[model samples]
Target: MNAKNSIAELARWIDALPNTRRLAGHELHNYRKQFVDGWRIDLNLAENVSINLLITAQFPFVSPKIALIDRTKFLSWPHVEKDGCLCVFPPNTNVDPYRPVEVAKSLVAETEALLQCLLDGNLDDDFNREFDSYWLLSSDDLRHQFFSILPDGCDSQKVAVWSSSKFRIIGADEKSVLCWLKNRLQKDYDRTDTGFLVKLSKPLSPEEYPDCTEALLALISEDAPNFLESISDHIAKSFQPLTIILAISATNGTNYGVVELCRLLRANEKVSKCGRSNRVSVNGFRDGKAPLSVQLSQQTKYTKVVRSPLERADAEWALGGRGHDPRFAVLQKQRVAIVGLGSFGSFLTDNLIQAGLGQVAMFDGDLMRWENTGRHLLGGDTVGQNKTDALKRRFETNYPTIVSCESNPVDWQQRIETAESLDGFDLVISTTGSWKAECMLNDLHECSGKRTPIVYAWLEPFAAAGHAVAIMERSGCLQCGFTGAGQFSRRVFDWPAAPTTMVSQAGCGNEFQPYGITDSLHSIAMAVDLSVECLLGQLTASTHRVWINKDRKIDPIQRGWSVAWQTVPNFDTREEVVSEFPWSARPDCQRCS
Candidate 1:
C-alpha cells in the first residue's frame, strides 16, 4: 500500500470507532510521522476506561499495538500482558497489504471483546488458570531471590536455613555466586544444623517503601501512605517474623511467590549481620508502641529481600535442560565405560554425555592423528597427543556434567586384564572397531556371569550400514553373530565377495574406509539409542539392531546386496529407522553355544 493510502484508510477507521479519535501530530516510537498512526479510545460506561492504539504504517497489513492507559489496575494473564497490551490476534496471522480493511475490523472486534472481558469479571478466571504464566510474565518485580530446598511441611520460624526458605528460584547457583559464601555457622546459629548460604542483592531501599517496619509491608504493589498499617496492627497477633518471600523469574520477566518474615524486634537485641563474615550486626528497634519520636527518629528501613524464583531444576531438570526426554533421568546414576576414543567412539560418547551419562571412563591406547581429525571430536591441533588425554581436556571443558571422565591411554585389554575391573560400571560401550577387542570384551562379559552389560557399536564400510549389539546375560554374545573368518566370514551385513573391503593407505599397516564423520554420526546415533535404553532398564532382552542407509552413495558400487541385508525386512527407508534383529544364535558359535 502507498504511504498516502495507508494513512487515509486508518483515518477513516479511527473516525468510525465509538468514542475514539486520531492522535494527530505524534512520534511513532521515535520514527518519523508516516511510520505510525495513533488513535485514542475512550469507552462510555459506568466507569470510563481508555486505551491507546499505535497502528504501524503496515496497518491493515500488520496488527496494531494496543495497550491500556492504567495497566496495574488490571490482572495479568495469557491474553493480557503485564504491560496491559491485549494479545488480540492469534499468532502468525496473514495480512494482505492490499487490504487494511479486514485487519482494522478484526482489531476493533478484539478491542471490544477485551473491554467486555475487563467489564464482566472474566479476566479473573483467566488469570487464575494461567497463574504461573502470568506470574512469570509479570514485571512488577525484578530483584534476585535466594532459594532453600527443603522437605515439605517444614516450619518457617524454625530457621531451617540451609533447607527451606519457602521460596522458588527458577535458577539455583551458589549463594556466593554474586558474593561470598556467608559463615552461617557462627555462634548466632547451631552448628549441628545444615544450611545453605544466600547472598542478598543489596537490601530493598526506602525510596519506594518509606518507613517500612515489618517485612509484610513489602507486599504493597503500589505507593500509599502508611501501607504497613495493617501489618503493624496485626503485629501483636504474630509470634515470629512474618516471612515474606518474593520470587522473580528470568522467564517472562515476572516476579512470583510472596513470603513475609516479621518479628517484634527486641530492644537492644542486635541480630547478627546478614553479611559475609557475620561480623557486623543489625540493631533491632521497630516497635509500634514506641514513641512516634522513637519510630521517626530511627533510620527508615525496608526489607531488601527480593525473592528470586526457580523452576525446580534438579538432576531430572538438568537432563531435560537441552530438550532431552526426562526419562533420561534414569541414567543419572549409571556409570559407563567407552572402550575407544576414535571418531565413532567420541561422537557416540558425546551423545551419551548429553543424554545424562553421569560418569564415564574413556579408554583409548592410540594418539590423535591429523588424518583422524575429519571424524574425531578432538581437533587436528590435538594431533600427536594421547587420544584419551585429548578427550579428557575436551570433555572437562565442554561437558562438565559428565561427573567423572577418567581417560587411560592404555589399551582396553590391559585395563580389563589388570587389577581395575569392569565390576563397578553399569554399561560398557565398545566402539574400538576391532573385532579382536570386541570379541575379548564379549568373552569377558559372558565369562563373568554377565555381571555387566556391554554394547558393541560399529559401522560398515562405505557407511552403508551400522550395527549395535547388546551382549548381556539374557542375549546372544558377540561370537554368536559370526561364523567363518577372513573374506569367507558369514556375519551381519557382510561385504560382497569381491574387491577386498579394506584399502591400503600408502603404508604398511594403515587401511581405512572412505566414509566421513557425517556418515559415522548415523552409526553413533544408533549406538547411543540402544545404550540409553539399556541404561534406562528398558532393554531387557539381548537384541541386535541394524541400520541400512539405502541412500548412502558408495564408491565402486557392488553388484548386489549381501544375503544378510535382505534378511532384515521391517523398516522405513524414508525415516531411516533401524531394522531390529532379535538374537539369532549361530549354530556353530563359540560363545553362547
Candidate 2:
C-alpha cells in the first residue's frame, strides 16, 4: 500500500480551484468519516455538463464518484449513464488502490477526455470499446418483452422469436432472435403452436449499431420485407410493451439474447410519441416505407442495442470449476466400450458420464420396457426407445465425445471378425448378466495380440450380492472365472446348491432375479471404481471383486434369515463380508492369465 502522494499535497492542489469550500464532519457512502480538511468544488467541464468534485478522506487512493451536476440541458449520450456517470475509464482497472494522488489525477484526466468525446458526438465509439460493460445498465432491468437463450459454442445463423408466447418464427423468421428457455420453458413452447425459423445474414454486422431504433428496423425490413407493416398494425392495436426481439447469431458462435443497442440522435420538431396515431412523421426521413422511424417520440435522444443471453454456460463452468481439474487430464484420452444398457449397465453408464469419460461407445440391443422404469436411467417416458440410443443421445449432448455404434456387441463382433481388428478400445465393460453375451465378449477378448482390457460386473439373484472381474490384456479372460455353467470358479463364499431367488413377473417365462434399484446402484458403484482404476493403468491382475449382504439367504420352512452366506474353508470369521472378497484366477484356465 505505497501511496504516491499524501493528503497535504492533495489539499494544496484543491485549494487552487475557484469555487472550492472546505467541508468538515462528512461521511462517504454508508461507511466512515469524511476528510476534516477536504475541498468540495464545482468545475465547468463541458458547455452543458458541470462536475461537482468532492475530495473525501479516501481521495487519491480511491477514485471519486463523478456525476453531471446539471444534466437536464445536455443530450443523453452512450458514455453517459442514467446517473450522469461518465464511462471514462475501463471497468475495474484499479492499477494502484493505495496510490492516492496518482488515482485522483488519472480520474480527472479520463473525465476530461470523456467530456470531449461526448461534445464531439463520438460517444458511440466508447460504447463499442467496452460493449460488455456498457450493457450492465440494462442487464438488470428485466422488463424487455422478448427473450432468447442461445446455446454456447454453436456456429448458428438462426433465430427463435416468440410472439404471444408462441414461436411464430419460421422460414424467414428463424434468422431473427435465434435461441432460449431451459427445459421447463421449452416444455411450455412444445405445448403451444410455436415454431422456429432461420433467417440468414448477408455479411451481417449492424451498420449503425447502438441505434436499434434505426438499425433493427432496417434489418427487419431487409430480411422480411413486410415486417414493418405488421409492427405498425400491432402498434396501432395495443398500448402494451410491444417487444419484437430479433435474436441473430453472433460471429464468434457464442450465444446472447439481443435486447437493444441505443444511440442518441437529434430531436425532430414535428415528431410524435409512439402509439400517438398511425398517420405519423419522423425527422429527416422522406419515405413512409420505414414505419418504425415514425414511432420515435424524441428527436435528440435514442439508443440501440443487440441482445445476448444473460445466462451463459461458460460463465457457469467458470463459477463451478467442473471438468477443470488437472488430475482428470490423464483420463481424457481413455476410450471405453460399455456392452449393456440394462439396469446395471445404464447406471454404470451414468457413473461414467459423471466421472468424465473421454470417448465412449455403447452397445445394447434391448428396448426400454415399462418394468425398467424402476431401475433404468432412460426413465418411463422412454419406455419403448432403444436403450443404447437413449443413453447415447444423453451423453453426447453433454459430454461431446460419445459415439453411437452401428450395432450391438454381438452383431458388431461378426462384422469385424475378418477386419483389421476390433481391439482399438482402451477398455471394454460388460454388465449384461447374460451368459451368452458374456461368452461372446470373452471370446473377443481372448483373441491373441489384442490390447483392450475388460471389466465385467453382475448382481446375483435378489441383488443379495454382486461381483466384478477386472482382467487386463493377456490376463485370464471371462471364461477363466467360471466353468461355462453360471458357476463361479470356487468362490471364497458359495451360494446354496438349490437357490430359489426368482420372482414371477408374468409367469415362469418372465421371471427375473428381483433386486431394488439401490442394490443395483451399489453394484455399479464398485464396478465404476474398478473400471476407472483399470483405465488409469493401475490394476493389472485378473481378479474378482464382490459385495455381500449378510442377510441374503432365508429359510423356506421357518421364514427366517439363513447364515448360509458361506465362503470356502479359509474364511476369516473377523473380516467384514461386504469389503473383502478377492478370488484369484486359476492358472490352468483356457484363456491364459
Candidate 3:
C-alpha cells in the first residue's frame, strides 16, 4: 500500500481502540500531513512518540519503534543508506518483506509494556542499559532491535522473578520501607489513639548465631498474638536487628500501656533499653558524673518528677514548654489552603485531612457538577453544592476538631483576600485549575513578606502523573521556575480564537476525567507527606522542590523525587527592596504574570 492508504488503515485501527480514538485520529492526521510536507521522517517520529513511551522502550528487544508521521512522510531509518533498507534483521527467523502493520503493532505493544512497567515500579537496571543500546540506533533498527534484546533466560521464569522478587526490590530499601510504613500507619490509625512500640532484642555477640536464632523464635512467639489480632495484617516488617516493632491501637491514655510495657522490659534486666517514649528517644548508658555507672531507675516505681504545682511550673519553664513544645505544636497546627476544589485538589485535600493536618481552608468558586461526580470527593448528595462547602463538610465530619474554612464566591481575586485574612499561617498550598490562580497565590506570598511557604500540587492526566510542590521562599516564583510555556499558555497564544472545547482540552477538561482513585490517592499522599517533612524542617534548603512523576515506567521507576536547591548568598550583602516588583512582575509571561 502507498503511504496514504497505509495511513488510512492505521487511522481505522486507532479508532477501534477504546478511548484513544480522538487522540489517535489527530495524531494520525498530523502524521500524514507532516509526511506529505518536507518534514524529515526521523524528526517527526521522535517528536510523535510520547515521553512515557520513549522511556519505556529503552530496552532493545523489549521496546518498540514509535514514529511521528505527517501524511505521506516516508524515510528510511537513519542507520539505513539512501535506498530504503534496515540495519537490523529478524533473529532466528527469515526476514520476510517488512510490513507497516507489523511495525505499528510493535510500537503499541512496547508503549503498553512501558506503562505497565512504570506502574509496577520495575524500571531501574534496565533504564541505563536500554539508553546506551539505543543512543545510536536508527528508527528502523530500534523497531527490530528491541525484539532481539530480550535476555536468553526463559520468559516464564523472568515473569515469575519480576512478579515476586525484582518487583519488590524496585522501591524497597531500609529508608524507603520505613518511611512507607510510617505513612501507612498515620493514614490507617487515628493519631490521638494509637502508639507504636519498637522493642530491641539483646545484641548478639560475635559467636552467638545460635543464640540469636533462639531469641528470634522467642520474640516471634511473643509478638504473634498481637500481630494476628490486629485489624490489618499489612503491617510492614523489616529484619535488621533482632527488634520487635509494634504499633498498638490506643484510645485516650491507652498509649501509656505500651509505655509501661517498655518500662517493665527495661526493669527486668532481661532486655536492655535501646529507645523509649511516645517519640523515639536515645538512652544513654551513663551520666557525665559517673564514668562506670549506669543510670538505673527503681523497678515498678514510676516517679512523677514533680510533686507540686510550683515544681511542675518550674519543670515546664526549664523545657520552654509554655503551652506545647513549639516544634511539635507547629506541625500539628499547620493551616493549609487548597485553592482548587476540582478532582486532583479534592483528592489532595482528603489526604491532607487523613494525615492529621489541623486546619484546612478550601477555596473554589465552582459548584459541584454532575460530570464531577465520577472523580470528585463529593458525590450524589452534593450535586449542586459549592465544591469548597462540600469539602469542608466532609472534612469536619471525619475530624471534628479540624478547623475547615470554605471560601465560596471566591475566584483568584477572592483567594488573595482569603489569604490575607489568615493570621500566622505556616504554609499556603495551591491546587487551583488556573495557572493564574497559582500565580496569584505566589504573588500573595511575595507581597505579604510573611516568609510563609507555598506548595503547588497537581497531576497532568495520562501523559504525566505527579504533583509539583514549590516552597516559594528563596526559590523563584512558579512563573520564573516554569521552563517553557505550558499547554494552556500555548493554546491561549497560538490560537487565541480557538473554541472553548479546544481550550478546555489544553486546560482542565482532562483533569475531570476519571482515573484510578488508588493512584490519585497515592500521589496525593506523597505530596502531603513531603509537605509534612518541609513543615518539620526535615528537608534541607538543598532538597526542597520535589517532582513526583507517576508516569515513569522504566526498569527502575523514578517516581517523583527531590531536586537539590541552588545556593543563595546571605541577604546582608545584597540591597533589600520593598517595592512590588517581585509581587507584581509578569515579564515575558503569557499566562499568570
Please report the candidate that would top TM-score against the real structure: 1
Query: Candidate 3: lDDT of 315?
Result: 13
lDDT of 3 by residue, 14-54 (tens): 55554342333333343321222111222112223332111
Ten contiguous residues minimizing lDDT sum, candidate 3:
154-163
User: Model 2: how large is the Cα RMSD against the reference?
Assistant: 12.8
Q: Which candidate has the top score in lDDT?
A: 1
Candidate 1: segments with Cα more than 4 A from true spot: 1-15, 25-27, 30-35, 42-47, 56-62, 71-84, 89-104, 119-213, 216-313, 321-326, 380-403, 418-420, 484-512, 550-560, 564-575
Per-residue C-alpha lDDT of model 2 across residues 1-593, encoded as one tens digit per residue? 33335566656666776776555443223223342344455645656445645444554555655555545422246665554545556666665666555666677778777777777877554444434444444453344333233333333233334445333222123332221222112223432212222233542322233344455556666665555555444332323333343333433332233443323333442323653333343455542434453544332134434343243332113222332554355555667778777788788876765565556677777787888877788787677888877776565544332222223533345443631354767788887776666777777667634477778888655565577888775555677667655455533333344344331110111125455687567667888988888877877676567665445345222222223334343433332244534445568766545
Among all windows of 10 consecutive residues in model 2, the one with the lowest summed lDDT is 502-511
Alpha-carbon error at 439 in model 3, in Å?
Answer: 2.0
**Candidate 1's error at 289, in angstroms?**
23
**Candidate with more favorable, higher TM-score: 1 or 3:** 1
Q: Cα miss at 326, model 2 (Å)? A: 3.2
Q: List the candidates' TM-scores in order.
A: 0.67, 0.49, 0.36
Q: In model 2, what lDDT does residue 152 have? A: 33
Deviation in angstroms for 411 in model 2?
5.1
Sort order, lDDT high to low: 1, 2, 3
